[model samples]
Structure formats: C-alpha cells, structure tokens
Target: MPKFAANLSMMFNEVPFPQRFAAAAAAGFKGVEFLFPYDHTPAEVAGWLRENQLENALFNMPPGDWAAGERGIAALPGREEEFRAGVARAIEYAQALGTKRLHMMAGLVPAGADADSYRATYLANLRFAARECGLHGISVLLEPINGRDMPGYFLQTQAQAHALREECGEPNVKVQMDFYHAQIMEGDLAMKFKRWFSDIGHVQIASVPARNEPDDGEVNYPYLFRLLDEQGYDGWIGCEYRPRGRTEDGLAWLAAYNQ
Candidate 1:
C-alpha cells in the first residue's frame, strides 16, 4: 500500500504552521513533508514530530529568496558559495529532525544565461551537495518541475533528472518524482515509474491541471498505487496538493489507505 504523507505547507492551513503537525496526525497521516522550515528552530519542528509520532519524510534545501521568487540557486553560476552554505544549514536541520532526504531545487534559469554554464554549475553543485549530505547519512534529491507551473526552472523531465543523477555518479543523489509535475510534462506515469524505479528517492502527488486532491484527477492514482505495491516501492508518497475545499474535507480518498 502507498504510505501517504501530508504536505503541511499545502494542507491543514486552517491553523498556523506549528499546529499543522498535530492536524496532520489527527487526520491519520503517518508522515509529513514541507517546502521550507527555515523560519522555525529545528528543535521546535522536531518536538512537533515527536509529539505527533509523525515521521519527517522530506523537505527542500533552502530555495533562495522564496518571497523574492528565486525558486532555487543551485543552477545559478555566481551563487555557489551561498548554495553551499544553504547545504550546510540544511544538514543541520536534517540532523536535528532525523530526516534522511533533502530536495535541492534547481534555480530558475535567467533569460539570456548560458545554458552550458548553468548546467555545469548545477552538476558541480549537485556533486558537492551529495558529498556533504552523504557524510551524515542523508540523501539529496533533484526534482523536475514543469515549465507551466514554474517557468524557467532548470530541471524539467525524468530523463534530464536521471541523466544528471548518473552524471553526478553519487550513490546518495536521487530523483524526486512528483506526479503533479510528471503528469503535466509526461503523461506515462506508470511507465516512467517502472523505468526509473531504481533511481527514485521520493514521490509526490496532486491532481493534474487543478493541483487538488488525487481522487478526481486525470491520473488514476488507484491504479498507480496498486502498481507501486506490486513493484515493492517502500517510500513515502507525499500529498503535495492544495485542497479544493477544506483540507480535512478532501481526505476521503486517503481514509481507505490510511490503515
């Protein structure tokens, strides 16, 4: 069965960030994930997890200036120092939170930027991140966001992500296969899952086009869930979607699988 983790960033918005941990647990989630936890102390976040008994499945390495719209800095040429610092900061939090996986966002590619240079920078930064994270038993993740949702984002396809992972040649660097982006860019979710089963480190899901709960989407999640079980995928499937209504009201689809 698919082990679902609520994305506290998108779900349980009725309360503040700190309270979402309990909200997710009360809703029967065994695990949880979020975009960034830089605003709070690691001890604070850790306390919530320990209190709720929810496993911290995943979280992204600090994306540069999120409010300023810098999705990530990993692919930016001159920001290598800042990117490395972010990696160290992320490791501190991961160690405190006992999180094993961290997603390294590829920054938005500036217009007129040299594609080759950006690719080189991204690859180098990824190798550095993998080495640093490996020392602490943490895995670094690379995700491909669709152009429609995140224009100019560096990584965009399963092939591209896998290729980069191979080029990095680091055992701990893996791909974060988000179905929301995958369905938007490539519709063959099952085939992609099977083809890259060995390289995937994490999974995320949301309805296509609407980015809502997976129950009423173009993608048949039930079929894919069965496929995951058949293939013996023992990883957290993050519910990284916005609810159409209240978050709790949209959990009927998850109730059957929560057990």
Candidate 2:
C-alpha cells in the first residue's frame, strides 16, 4: 500500500485550517501537506502537528501577495531580496513543524519579460533557496505545475525542473513529482518515474484530465502505487485533488487501498 498525506488545503475543506489537522488524523492520514501556512504562526502550526501526531510533510515558501495574483516572486526580476527573505521564513516554519521539504513555485513569466532574464533570476533564487534550506537539513523541491491549472506558471515540465536544478547546481535542489501535472504535460508514468527516480524528492497524486480522486481518473493508481513501492520511492504521495463529492466521501479509493 502507498502512504498518502492528506492535502489539507484541498482535502479537509470541511473545517478551517487549524482544525484540519485533527480532521486528517481521524481520516487515517499519517502526514499532511498544504500550499502555505503563513497566516498561522509556526508555533501554532507546530502545535497542530504535535497534538495530532502527524508528520509535517510539505509546504511552500512565502509566495508574495498570493491574493494579488502573485503565485510566487522568486523569478520576478528585482525580487531577490524578498525571495531570500521568504526562504528564511519558510525554513523557520519547516523547523517548527518538523517538515523535511519545502517547495518553491516559479511564478508566472511577466508578459514581455526577457526569457533569459526569467531563467537567470529563477535559477539564482533556487540556488539561494536550496543552499539556505540545506543548512537546516531540509530539501528544496521544485514542482512543475501544469499551465492549464495555472496559466503562465513558469515551470511546466519535469524536464524543465531538472534542467533548472542542474543549472542551479544545488545539491539540495530536487524534483517534487506530481503525477497529475506529469500526466497533463508528458506522461509515461511508470517509465518516467523510474527514469527520474534519483532526482525526485517527493510525489503527489491526482487524476489526469480532471484532477479528481485517483479512482475515477485515467491513471490506474493501484499499478502506480505498486510501481512506486517496487521502485522504493519512500516519500509522501500528497493527495492533491478536488473531491468529486464531499472530500471524505470521495476517499473510497484511499479506503480500498488501505491507506
């Protein structure tokens, strides 16, 4: 069976952020992950993880002004100071929550922005983030988000992520493989998983074409789970999907998998 972490942001919407910790624990998830935890103090978030006996699996760094249509500022020109500062804040939260990995989103490329400029800023930011996070024994993961869900999202393919990681040359930089995104972009799931296994640090799952529970998607999750197990991918598979029904009710797939 595959070990899954409830994506608190998407899964436990029945309650508020603070309460979702207990909700996930009750749902048989040993770990939990979310997009961001900045609204709550790290200490407050840590208390939730500790009291619920859950592993703080993953989270993203402070993306600038998320409400202002800013997904992240790491690749935005002239935001280097803010990007580095955000990394520090994220590291504090990771330490407090006992999380081992933090994801860095590459914000949209500004229209008319120089392509080379975007890549340079992005790689530089990733290098700094990876090095800083490394000091605290945390890995920095770069996730290639599909443009369909996030139009203009900077990183949109696994190969792009790998290329950036290599360019940054940071030992702590690794890939956060989301099967949903991979399927959307370039999917040969089993083969790609094996090919990129060494560069991958985390995994996430959702159905293809319609980001729903794994049971109803084009993906055969049972076989995928078996593939991961056989390949020894010992990382959390974050359940990041929109539920077809009430989130709990839609978890029959997980239940059947004995998660």
Candidate 3:
C-alpha cells in the first residue's frame, strides 16, 4: 500500500493544528503535511509529531504576500536577499521538525517582467538553496499551481518545473507533482507521472471539479492508486483536499477502500 499523509491544512480545517496531527494519526495516516508551521515554535511542532508518531512529509517555505497577490518572488529580480532568507528560515524549521521535504513557492511575476531575467534569478536562488539544503539532507521541491486557482503564479506546469530543475542541475531540488494542478494544467495524469517520476520528489492529490474528497469528483482514484502501486511509488501521497462536509464524514471513502 502507498504510504499516505494527510494535508492538515486542507483535510482538517475543522480542527486545530495540533489536534489535526492527532486526528491524522488516529486515521491511520503515517505522515502529515501542512502549509507552514512557522506560527508555532519548531520545538513545539517537533514534540507534537513525536508524540503522535507521525512524520512531517512536507511543508512550505515562507510565501511573502502570497495571499495579497504578491505571489512568489523567489525568482523575482531584486528579491534575491529576501528569497535567500526565506530558504534559510525554511531549512532551520525543517531541521528542527525533522522534515525532509521543503516546497519552494516560486512567487508570481509582475506584468511585463522580463521572463528571461526572472528565470535567471530563479535558477540562481535554486542553486544556492539546493546546495544549502543538501548539507542538511533536505530536498527542496518546486510546485506548479493552476492558473484558475491561483492566477499570475510564476510556475504553473510540470514542464516548467522540470526545466527549472534541469537548469538548476542540483540533485537536492525536484518538482512537487500536485495532481490537482497537473490535472487542470495538463491531462494524461498517468503518462505524465511515468515521464516525470524521476524528477518528482513528492505528490499531492484532490479530486477534480470540486477539490473535495478523492471519491467526490471526476478523478478515478482507485485506478490512479493502482497505477501508483504499479509504478512502485513509495512516497507519501498527501490527502490535500477540502472537506465538503465534516472532515471525518468526508473520509467515508477511505474506510470503503480499507474494506
């Protein structure tokens, strides 16, 4: 069976963060991922994970003004210092929390910003971050968001993420294959999975059309899960979906799967 992790940010919004950790453990998940744990002290987060016997599968680096339309500026010109500081802080937090994967949010580009300049800046920042993370034994992942969900985001396709990884030429940096965004930006989920499996460091999922539970929408998850098994993907598949109803109530499909 694929190792499963609950995306506490999306899956257990109805519960408090610490409580979400406990709930995920009770739900039979081996690991958990969250947006950011910066609000709480790293020691506190680490304690919670150890108490629950759950792994921190992934977490985001600081996203400066991501909600205010500033989007990611990790690769934006003149923001190199800010990006480096963010990566350093993220590495510190990951080390404290015993996290192995850090998702680097490549911020949004300003209108008419030179694409070449932004790409160059991004590559430089990635090289530095990857080298630093390598020393700490942590892998940094780049995620591509869907334009429909997050307009003006800098990276929005697997192809772009793959290219950036190639350009960076760093073994510690890889793509975070979010199935929800990939399904929206490009179809052929299984084939894409096969093609980019080597470059991928982590995977997240939610059903299409509704962004709800895996069984609530168009994506055939059973088939997809089977495909993942066939491909020998041993990484955590995060349950990163919003609950249309009570969180536990929405998880009925998982019980059915178990049965």
Candidate 4:
C-alpha cells in the first residue's frame, strides 16, 4: 500500500503540534509532513516524532518572502550569504528530526533578472546545500509550484525542475512532484509520473478543482495510488490540501486506499 502522510499544517490547523502528531498516528498514518517546523526547536520536534513513532516525510526550507512577491533568489548575486544561512538552519532542523528529505524553496525569478545569472546562482546554492545534506544522508528536493497558483514562482514546470536537478548534477538533489499543480500545468499525469519517476524524490496531492478530499474532486486517486504501487514508488504521498469541512470529516476518503 502507498503510505500516506497527513500534512499537519493543513489537516490539523488550530491543533497544537504535539497533538497533531499524535492524531495522525492514531488515524493510522505512519508519517506526517509539516510546513515549517523550525518555529519549534529540532530537539522538541524530534521528541514528538519519536513519541508518536512517525516519520518526518518532508518539510520546507525557509520560504524567505517567496509568499510575498520577493521570489527566492537563492542564486541572486547579492543573496548568496542569506541562502547559505537558510540551508544551514534547515540542515540543523532536519538532523534533529531524522528527516531524509528537505524541500528547497526556489524563489521566483526577479523581473529583469538575467536568466543566466539566476540559473548560475541557483545551481551554485543547490550544489552547496546538496553537499551539506549529503553529509547527513539527507536529500534536498526542489519543488515547482504552478504559476497559476503561485504566479512568478521560479520553478513551475517538471521539465524545468528536472533540468535544474540535472544542471546542479548533485546526486542528493531531486524534484518534488506535486500532483495538483502538475495536473493544472501538465496533463497526462501517469505519463509524467513514468517519465520523471527517476528524478522525483517526493509526491504530494489534493484533488483537482476544489483541492479538497481526494474523492471530492476530479482526479482518480484510486488509479493513481494503484499506479504508484505498481511502479514500486516507495515514497509518501502527502495529504496536502484544504479541508472542505472538519479535517476528520474528509479523512474517510483515505479509507478507500488505506484498507
């Protein structure tokens, strides 16, 4: 069966972190992913995970204004120092949590920023972060957000994310394939899954249209789950979506596959 990880940020909003961890474990999920656990010390977060016996599937590196229009310039000429510091902080937390994967937020490319310069800067930062993560046996993943959902984001396409991973040439750096965004930006979901499976380090999903429960929207998640199982994809498919009602109310959809 495809292991499911509740996205605590979305699922258990209003619940304290420790409670969220325990709730996910009680719900029969073996793993959980949070948006940013840095607010809590790594040791504290690690202790919670151990208490619940859950794995930390994925967590974001500091977004650093990517949510505003600042677009991450990890490769920006003047921001190299800031990027390095961010990576170091992330590594520290990932180590404490015993997480194997860290998602690098590639900020949007600035207006009039030379593509070559941005690319070079991004590649440089990625290489540096990859080395740090490699030392801890952690893999760094770059996620491409949809321009529709996150306009002006730097990495928006799987092809672009794939190319960046190739250019960085770091074995520890790979792509995070988010099905909701991919369904919007690129169709032929299964084909993309097949083509990019080799480079995809992690996966996340919510149903299309409403971005609610998997059964409440257009995607055929049962088939998708079956595809992942058949292909032997052994990564967590994170439940990253907005709850249409109470979070637990929508969890029944997972029963289809959880059984």
Error of 3 at 255 (Å): 2.4
Candidate 3 structure quality by residue, lDDT tens digits, 51-92 = 999999999988887567666667788988888898889988
Best model per TM-score: 1
RMSD to truth, every model: 0.6, 1.1, 1.4, 1.6
lDDT of 1 by residue, 127-201 (tens): 999999999999999999999999999999999999999999999999999999999998899999999998899
Per-residue lDDT tens digits for candidate 4, residues 1-259, read: 8889999988877587778998888788899998888778888899989999999999987767645656555656778888888888998998889889999887777578798887888888899999999999999998888888777777888999899899888899989988898888876889989998988899999999778878867788888889999889999999999888878777887776667
RMSD of 4: 1.6
Regions of candidate 4 where Cα sits further than 4 Å from its true position: 66-71
lDDT winner, 2 or 3? 2
Q: What TM-score fits each model? A: 0.99, 0.97, 0.96, 0.95
Report the lDDT of model 1 for residue 123: 97
Which of the two, 1 or 2, has more TM-score?
1
Evaluated with lDDT, which candidate comes out highest?
A: 1
Candidate 2 Cα lDDT to native:
0.89
Q: Each candidate: how many clashes? A: 0, 0, 3, 4
Predictions in order: lDDT? 0.95, 0.89, 0.87, 0.85
How much is 147 displaced in model 4, in angstroms? 0.7
